[model samples]
Target: MRALRALRPVQEPPARVTRITVHRPSPPLDGLVELIWAADSYVAQAERERVLPSGAQSLVVHLGNGPLRVFTDEDAIDATEVSGAIVCGARVTPLLIDTALGPTVGVEFKPGGARPFFDLPADAITGRVVSLDALWGASAHSLRERLMETSSPRDRVRLLEDNLLRRLARSFELDAALRLSLDAFEGRDLTSVGEVNRRTGLSPKRLLALFRDEVGLSPKAFWRVRRFRSALRALDHGTLRGAAVAAEHGYFDQAHFVREFRSLAGSTPREYLAARVVGTDHVSVRR
Candidate 1:
């Protein structure tokens, strides 16, 4: 695959565009996905395909003058002149859409990376489109628009991070616990959920509940997905062999890895690598 632009967010307008901000993964977060941005004049006909990996979620903020339509396997949502937010959770199918007008700034948070921002059960979102006003208040739309209007990309990122923290403040403590457990698992195979609970000083049941609320997925599911992403990045970097990648990421073996890969990525490692070369404009995936 082509060397991805750095993980930092980029602000650049394509032809006939006013402005666009692309947010990449953070350096320490090499396993996450990239975020795309489009300007008011931006318009594209998206293919009828699912675009995100399992456990992934996206938050979109509309900053332009027009509206945009998002199509899921079952539903189509028209977010018009809605200078607000929309959250897309893990979908079994892809979203197809034809943009009419306006600029849309979005943040694509990968499986593990997005856990801290949401404090609801992962399954709570199935394949549904929700407005920011539905989650936050009416003022949320205007606030998001103002932040997106910031001229500086750095300022925009800071604003985004701040907003994320604010929205997830109730779940911050749970995120802290999860981060601690994740760090404990680094450089070693992940142990049982009970161990994670012990390390975090939370009961296993409480941990699961908190994790599901804050991160959207159960802790075990989050761990598995995060490990999968770790393996994917290693393979993407050409630093780990398939068998070794599975072992290193806490999979029982290559078979386990392949199963999880197929379930989450819809392909095997080799096939995913092959497709990765062709879909350079978007995020990487492992089948």
Candidate 2:
């Protein structure tokens, strides 16, 4: 249950880390871990990046980096400094992250996937970032020390995955109804709440309560983010017009798509795409 399946990571450390490519986790942790991603010191310039919501949470490990700096808003008020490993919660809105740092690694958790390990409601940490040491105590600090000494990304991943398996909850079990709802919501384009209920046979109230407890975001909210991400994928994969991309993703209209884009991305589609840095989500913005 604790063994890693295999490694097929892309060997391009110079690129910004977007998705996991190496050291797939074992079966026991599959429902919890969606991916494992890492990045080297690709850029040294002091800059800010907009981190859009992915309807998932993450545990980020800073390997010998100074610290992870996060701002509540563009104004950078009450910024939080995270050292070692940190748990990044679900984001209902875009976030401003300090991009003036070094190499890092992270584990992206699937929707409703983090419940078993933390012994708390998923919404407790949603839209917030908490240190791993705060959650896992001495074990987190020890893991960071081991990672700081190892230079290989593979070793880091192995260590991370092994530790996660060790920390796997023995008493908790994944909700069956939530899995059906997630599949229904993610399987179709523009899946409606009613459709999800029809597929899962759960009342709207039950669905909402389940999401709040198990997944942080409500069912409808999670589906909205999923739709937004679909549009992002379409845009990334091709050179399509905004209207065309909107249609492909089942947005109500170009105007509606733009509004959602601007709301979650902190910029219009044109602006974000035009200023996008190649091979990464980081965008150039004036400080």
Model 1, range 49-92, lDDT digits (tens) per residue? Answer: 23434445777776655444554322434422333577776554
lDDT at position 280, candidate 1? 24
Q: lDDT of each model, Cα atoms only?
A: 0.55, 0.73
Of the candidates shown, which would achieve the greatest lDDT relative to the real structure?
2
Off by over 4 Å in 1: 1-57, 63-84, 89-102, 108-128, 144-176, 185-188, 277-287
Please give the range of 10 consecutive residues that has the lowest summed lDDT in model 2. 1-10
Question: Any idea what lDDT model 2 has?
Answer: 0.73
What is the TM-score of candidate 2?
Answer: 0.87
Give residue 272's error in model 1 in angstroms: 2.3
TM-score per candidate, chains pooled: 0.63, 0.87
Model 2 has a clash total of 1
lDDT of 1: 0.55
Candidate 2, residues 105-224, lDDT tens digits: the string is: 778788888877677888888889899998889988998898878777677777778778878845344688988888888774534789899888999999999998888898878888
